[model samples]
Every structure is written in C-alpha cells, then in structure tokens.
Target: MFDRHKSTPAFTRFTYFTFTYFTHFVRSAMTAFTLIILTFIIASIFHGLTGIGVTLIATTALASSYPMSHVLVLTVIPCLLINLVVFLDGGRIVYYLKKYWLLVLTSFVGSFIGTKLVFIIASHHLLIALGLLIVGYVAMQFVAMSVGKNFKLPNTTPSLVISGTIAGVLGGATNAMSPLLVMYLLSATEYTDDPKTELIKASNLCYVVGKIAQLIVL
Candidate 1:
C-alpha cells in the first residue's frame, strides 16, 4: 500500500497521450500531405509548360504553407527526378553530355565546394536568397529581350566559367541554382528571350557530367 495511486510525472503524462493527441497528429500529417501534393502539381505544370525550373515554381508555391527549409529539401527530389525522366525519355542526354564538357566539369567542382559551405551556414536565408536571385535574373532577361539590343558585357569563356562555378556552388547549397545557371547561359548567347530552353539544355549536360564525377569521387 505504499503508492497504489501515485501521480505520474508531467512528462510521462504528456508522452502517454490519450486519443486526442493521436487525432491531432493524424490531422496535421494529412494537412501537410495534401499541401505537398498541391505544390507538386503546380510545380510540374509550370515546368512542363514553360520549361521554367521546377525548384522556382515549387518553392514559391509551398513557401506560404510549409517551412522553407523543408520545401528546399523536397524541391531537390522532384527537380532531379524530373530531369532524370526527361533525359531517359528524350534521347538528348548523350549528345549534350559530349558537347558541353567544360561546363559540366566546372559545375561539379564548384558544386562540391558549395555543398560543404552550405552545411556551415544557416538555412533560413538560403531559400530567400535563391528566390530573390531568380526573380532578379528573370526580370533582367526580360528587359534585355525587349530592347533587342546587344550589350557587350563580357567575353563568354570567362563569364561562362565563372557563372558555372557560382551556379554549381549556389545550386548545391540551396537547390535553387537553376536561376543562376540560366542567367549564365543567357549571358553566353545573345538571345535572352530563349534562355529557358538554352538553360535547360546546359543544365542537363552539366548534371550528367557532375553525376559521373560524383560517382567516381564519392
């Protein structure tokens, strides 16, 4: 008869939740699952129709409802998967891989370094920075295309090499590097209006190269 009805610890009481706790957990999980599906649908539509990067569409759509950090991680899976699907189905992978060898090698090297840096920095700011960069790059490209005026900003070799490096590094960090990559590809060619297509091509080639290198090194 020492303690037939001893009181439970507050922590224990909380851990041994009643029916209400599980109900709430299930409800929250269902809500999150629905939101994820919605975001994926919107992102897929945007990418398929306009060839815009999936990360851009997915991040913006999920930003309001989901934590930015979570969205960023989820974004990478779809982006990479979509690319893999396109590569396997379209038959362009082999051709482009051989064509843009330098861009591919440079991106891998830069991305490897960038990935390490990302682990050291805070997560919240990463997505915001990437979003802003995308918006800004798109705006600039639109303006250039409208004017249809050739502005000799810099030579292609140095600019491509530098931008590819930066894109790989930033892409590795935030998974939103497509905007920067697109910007670099646009700068390489005179026609800014057609950057989305060109950027997609460049990215495909770079990804193939980077993956091969990663396989070997890692």
Candidate 2:
C-alpha cells in the first residue's frame, strides 16, 4: 500500500553525514601538517649550530605535544634506521673495518655492556644529567681554543681496553656516549698541528657504531 515514488529520507541523511565527517577529517589533517612543519623548522635551527642538537630539539618539540614515553618509543627505530643508512652510505663502515678493526670490536663489546646498564637504571634523570654535562663541557672547550694543548692519550693495548670499558660504562648510563668517546680518543693521540682528518673520521665511525649498537640492544 506504500507509494512507489516515495524518496527514502534515511539514505539522503546518511550521505550528508558521511560528507561532513570527511570534510572535518581533511581540515584536521591540514592543521597537524602545519604544526609538524613548525617543529621541523625549530629543530633545524638547533641542528645548524651543532650536529648533535637535532635529536634533542626534535624530541623536545614532540614531547610538548605528545606523551614523553610515546615520543621516545616512536623516535628510536627511525633514528636507528637513519644511522644505519649513513654508516653504510658514507663509507664509514668500510673505513673502520679496514683500518680500525680492534677499535670497532672493542666498542661493540663495550656497547653490549652499556645496553645492559640502560635496563638497570630505573630513572632517566641520570642520562639527562650526563647529556647536559657532556654538552656543557664541549661548549666550554669550543670557547677555549687552547684547551686541547698538551693532551696526551694512552696509546697501549691495556689503555685502549680501559678506555673502551669506561666509555661503555658511560654509554650504558646515558643514551649518548660520543663526548666521552671523543675525549678518550683525543687523549690517546698526539694530534697537535697535524691534519687530523683521519682521526675525525674514525671518531665519527665510533659514534655511528655506538649509536647503532644501542639501537639494537635497547
């Protein structure tokens, strides 16, 4: 007995609701995109001044808008992947394997120990304190150009072992270890007035490997 020509109001209302939902979703996505761009710009400014600043800067920015634990978890894998790519593509791996196999091996062993330590630490404040101290010391060194004069490094096997072990311990305590690693390397070398290009490259290699190993262990 119903009229065959009658339009169904339910179908028309559903179509209108779906369209409205999609429109709102698109607007929200655009807003998020804008926010991320702003964060990247701020991070980039830090990176320009110091190579190690980007991660901290970006992490801070993300933490401002997201949960700290969530941001830390999200950043780990991508940072690891990026370091892997740079280590491989930049010939750093080949350089270390060819010229500094022992350094690489010792660092690997140390990194394993460090990774275990990270699990033992209940609070993250120690790591933050260490990171701040490292950055501060480096900044002071940069301000005083003559500070590295007469820096003599231990150049024996036993010394290398001890250095690696201590570096490993610090690395375990903090997510960062490059500052300690570099200082140890410099102390062992008599690099005054000589081109230290190779030494610089080797230090970078250590950092790359240490970071990658941390990523794996953590």
Candidate 3:
C-alpha cells in the first residue's frame, strides 16, 4: 500500500519539522497530565485537612489546557462528588442547615444569579473576575492566618448573607468558592472553639449547595 518517492530538501525539512512538532505535543500533553495528577493528590490532602482547595487546585491545573469556563464545568462533577463525601463524612447535615439556613439560602440565590451571569458575560471578563477573586481569597486567607482565631466576623444575619453571597458568586463563576466559604466559617464566632470541625462541615455544605445550584442553572 506504500509507494516510494525521491525525497527533496523540502520534504526532508517537512519531515523533521513534523516529527519535532509531534514530539513537543506529546511532551506537553504528558506534562499536563502529570501536573494534573500531582495537583489532584495535593488538593485531596488539602481537602482532607481543610475541606477546601480541590476545586481551586484542579482549576489552576486544568486551566493550562482548557478555558476558564470549561474548567468551571469540568470541575463541577468532581466538586459535587468530593463535597458530598465530605458532607456525609462530617454528618449532622440537618443541624448545620438549620443553623445556617440564611447563609445557605443567600448563597444559593447568589449562585443562581452568578450562573446566569456566566452565560451572559464574555469569557475574558469572567476569566478576569475569576483571577481577581482567587487573589482576594488568598489575601484574605493570609490575613486570617496572621490574625488568628480571635479575629472573627460577628455571626449576624447580615454578615452571613454577605459572606454567603460572595461565596456563591465566586463559586458560580469559577467553581472555586470553597476558600471563601471556609474563610467565612472560620471567622464566624459560632465556629470559634472548634473551628476546624465546623469549618469542614460548613464549607462542605456550602460547596455542595453551590455546586447543586450551578448544576441546576448551568
């Protein structure tokens, strides 16, 4: 099925270039796969410790190959599955929901609005917004770490609403709202004593609720 032909200089050059391009593509794809695996491992560890970071880490890793919008969608199933595991593991879902119903409801509404906006807004603008939100989340986390457990927002309706809304918007836009929810939970007075446990519980709940809202809206 093969025919032999004399190779010209141009043909030689084309063959070399094609091989080089193929090699590079293979290497790049392998590198991305390896990084994604590593990111998943690290994110899982962080999730176990803090009930957050899986979406953020996975998004950061996969953004190399996909658009932010696609990354957000790709993360939904994984986030929902992981959050469900965490939420069930933590147990007492009813108690947390009853205690933080306002936050949950506000977050759901905010997420609903955010999901709608994601469809309306330009992709580049959404990418810009996602980048800013991630940076802000990192800064807030740093501040919380430096300030310690004593630094807390009042556990009032307004605070909960604001935090939940912000979390919902970010979550809806990027699927990376766990950090904000964790921050809000950690800073709330209700979780002051055993913040780690409460943080995991509330953060997982928020993530589950946010992911569900995104699923419905998207």
Candidate 4:
C-alpha cells in the first residue's frame, strides 16, 4: 500500500524549476518574434531611405527584453542577409572588395577578436556598454549633421584602419556600426560631393564582412 499520489520533495522542486524555466523561455521567444517583425518593417523603410538603421532598429527593439549579447547574436543573420541583398542590388561587390580590401581585412580581424570578447564579458556589463555606445553614436551623428559639409576627415591609411577597427568592435558588440561607418565615409572629401551611392556600397561591404566574421566566431 505505497502512497501513489505523493511525490518526493526533490522531485517536486525539480518539476517546479523546469516548468518555470520553460514558461520564461516561451514568453521571451514570443515577445522577441513579435518585436522583430514590427522592427523589421520600420527598419526596412529607414534603410531604404538611408543606407543605415536596420541593425540599430532591430538591436534596440530586442535589447530591453533580452541580453544585449543575445540581441547581437540574433541580429547577425538578418543583418548579413539584408546587406547581401543590398550589395547584390548595387552590383558593385567586386569593386568595393578590390578598393577597400585593406580596410575590410582589418575589420574582419577586429570583429573576430571582438566577438570572442563578447562571450567573455558578463551580460549586464555588455548591456550597459551597448547602451553607452548607442548614445555616443547618436550624439556624434547629431553633431556631424549639425555642422554640415564643413567638417572633414582625411581618409589616410591610419584613419581608415582606426575607424574600421572601431566599427568592427562596435558591430561585434552591438550590431550597430553604420553610424561610425557612415560618418567616416561622409567626412572624406572625395565622398562629400554626392555620397549616397558610394556610402551605401561601402557600408554594405563592411557590414557583410563584419557579419561573416561574427557568424564564424559565434
């Protein structure tokens, strides 16, 4: 006459914890899916008008509910796909690769190292760092736009290498590198006349390389 209905205390605790974890996972997944859909549409519109904002929009949307590292990882595929589409549409992939090979190579190296760092860092610290990076990028953009065409950043070898490295690290950490990339390109005197097409092409190429490196590291 064993008690068939009674469960052991350890078994009860295990069941409770398992169910709680499953419930939280399901809720987070659902919320992430919904936010991604909404943000994709909005980001697409902005990306169409300007050659940026897709990753920023997606990362910002997911950052509140999920860890920043998770958001960066999840956005990598989508960002890569979108950049591929844009790169193909422009029909200048070969030209960009040939022209900016050095910059691209350095960026890839930086991104590989940065991606490794993401895993080593704590989740809370990553979130705070990402927040500050986003804020700094926005402020930099505002000031640059306010200053208009007067500002200039020479595209020397050192400048390109430094900017590319910074862009790669930021891209790896938060998946938001367009602000820095765009600013760097815009500041160049050659690109100052009419930068839209060149800017889009260059940024897409850089993003494609960075995303590929991130996927490899991940």
Best by lDDT: 4
| Model 2: lowest-lDDT 10 consecutive positions | 47-56
lDDT of 1 by residue, 121-152 (tens): 76667757767776876677788789985233
Q: Best candidate per TM-score, number?
A: 4
Q: List the residue pairs that clash in candidate 1.
A: none
- Ten-residue segment with the worst summed lDDT in candidate 1? 209-218
By TM-score rank, best first, the candidates go 4, 3, 1, 2
Report every candidate's CA lDDT: 0.63, 0.56, 0.76, 0.77
For candidate 3, which ten residues in a row score worst on lDDT? 1-10
Candidate 3 achieves a global lDDT of 0.76
Compared with the true structure, what per-residue lDDT tens digits does model 3 show for residues 31-76? 8778767877787888878666788778777775777667767778
The estimated TM-scores of all candidates read 0.73, 0.56, 0.76, 0.82
Poorly placed runs, candidate 2 (over 4 Å): 1-95, 128-132, 139-152, 187-195
Q: Residues 65-154, candidate 2: write the lDDT tens digits.
A: 554344444445544444344445446457556765666667767866766665565445544655475677667577656675533347
Rank by lDDT, highest first: 4, 3, 1, 2
Better of 2 and 4 by lDDT: 4
Task: Per model, state how many residue pairs clash.
Answer: 0, 2, 0, 0
lDDT of 4: 0.77
